[model samples]
Target chain A: MAEALNKAGSYFIGLVRVIVMRILIAEDDLDSQTLLKVILQKEGHEIVTADNGLAAWEKFQQEDIHLLITDWVMPEMSGLDLCKKIRAQKTSEAVYIIMVTAKEEKQDLITAIDAGANDYITKPYDKGELIARVRSGERMVSLEQELINKNKEIYSEKEKSEQLLLSIFPRFIVERLKQGEVVADSCPDVTVLFADINNFANIFSRKEPVELVEILGQLFSVFDRLVSAHGLEKIKTIGDTYMAVGGIRKIRRL
Target chain B: MDSNEKEKIVVSVDPDFEEIIPGFLEHRREDIKKILEALDGNDFEGIRIIGHTMKGVGGGYGFDAISDIGRFIEAAAKENRPEDIRQHTEELASYIDRVEVVYE
Candidate 1:
């Protein structure tokens, strides 16, 4: 009998050390918090503890907490509130929240679920049950991490697509394309026109070289508009002279 | 409709709104506010500067309607034609009123 009992004790001990999860325990009671931390640490899991939900949230933001083992009630915020906040972020990879409550009624379980907890463990709980619950939570955390990785990949791909779109067209055109607009087709009978600025050298003949460039920019804005108004394509610009072409859709050269 | 015909149709059926209505509305409102302020001050030079910038930017975005209005404003400002600018300003305001930015 003694040998069997000793073997069982060793087996339970081994089970605790084999599972690796970073758990954050939110319990206001000092002794309870320490006990839970020690229990989880012995199981080969890293432990973080907060006396209230607010502190837990702060810790959550600062670190990658895989599982939350929180009391049902605490100062600052309740465990339910914490779970709700975590789920709402959607940015959080996925976290397994197991509410540690003294309540045993069906209503309590319903409340926990509504608030986003994945599981619940009753107080005065059996050590074996506690360990089993945690192990299950580890599985949930792994699944969540997978989802997080997938979301990251999607986000990165979206950024790359935006960059490519920006390079190909102006931001407005890119936005139109993103909205599913058919804007790239050629306009039928669209006339393109080009115009060159008059007096290629005379406009800047009397001004300093640097001032000439600045003045030219202000002056050339006029021609740029006239061409745009007539739907003329600006083929190129050479110093004081600007060249634009008209007749793209329906050839009407001007 | 076949895939090709469906693809030919503009993504946004609304001739005015092409993409992200709320985003564009917010941007245009802000820009129009600045243009109005510049106009009120009898600052044709400032009007020309602002209108010219809007013309290029609006055109690039495929908001041809807004771009054309911006060009009109730019032209009037360049020629110091106050009456033409006043008429274009009203047209621009009407365009803004016509625009409906869908939240969805």
Candidate 2:
């Protein structure tokens, strides 16, 4: 879930950032291509250019381009066909295609939109309008990216809480707490162990209680290692006995 | 040279695009030749392509006159008006000759 969410998040953020712009321009004419490239470059954008529709399509196939500006007519392929192709691909990424062309008739605009162009611009386009549309698209994509990032953060927080809770309490108790129920339930199949050091009386005769405690500490250390290794929960250590239990939170074969 | 040939006409363009103006004008000069050849062969399609290219790029570089001529050229080719194509082709040549781009 985390990996998939990150992939989706990056897809949106990479397309439009507030500081830097990532754009692709598909125009066959060298003069128009240069102007468009220069205009966006002045705005601090990174750009890719394609001379014809087929070349543009190939570039799109090679990588993910979320924002594209294309001319309507070209050799090998038309902008409308390219729009249809991009829309047909099954991917989580969202695309914003702006069709720039000399086709200014009412029907041409309608046809381009129907073929999956998000926006349309007639020839002799205003420079201000071009930048404004790009800004608007970037705004929309940025808002959506922000929302996805927020959701991802919330998901991470939920997972962290779950891990912290599971460390302190048993699974069943945690589940009960989650449901807002009083967490009092009987644990089945738990094995309680009361282990004592060997030669308990003789060792006590030979040593003082302070010295006996040192030996008890060493014994408990060994038992501590075994408890974690076998996935058992330690209850307590009283006097000379070490108490532990298994199957309280998690089930195990003893 | 005509009396008005050296009469400098200034066109304001973005200074950032100064480098591209030369190449753009060169392409238009090439188009004049291509248009004349296409007319000789009566290749309406070839003429139409060049005209379409001009209409698309001319206004973008702040040369609205070039775009107007291009639009007319394209329309004339479609209607098979060879006289109008020749007229527009001459207009394009004159426009290029007099344009003095004053980069802003």
Q: Pick the candidate with the highest lDDT.
A: 2
Badly placed stretches (over 4 Å) of model 2 are A1-17, A151-254, B1-8
Per-residue lDDT over A1-254 for candidate 1, one digit per residue giving the tens place of the 0 to 100 score: 22323311121344542224668998875545654665576677778889999999999998777889988767899999999999998665567889987555799999999999989876545446777899898877766666776988999999999987774454555677788877755556544444455675775578898997887777668877887787665555567666665655242221
DockQ, every prediction? 0.00, 0.70
Alpha-carbon error at A160 in model 1, in Å? 1.9
Docking outcome class, model 1: incorrect
- The list of candidate 1 runs beyond 4 A from truth reads A1-20, A88-90, A180-254, B1-104
Give TM-score values for chain A, per-prediction: 0.60, 0.57
Q: DockQ (C-alpha) of model 1?
A: 0.00
Residue A90 lDDT in model 1? 67
lDDT of 1 by residue, B5-48 (tens): 33221222232233334554456666667767877787888777
Positional deviation of residue A232's Cα in model 2 after best superposition, in angstroms: 18
Interface RMS deviation of candidate 2: 1.1
Worst 10 residues of 2 chain A by lDDT: A1-10
What shift in Å separates residue A3 of candidate 1 from its native position after superposition? 38
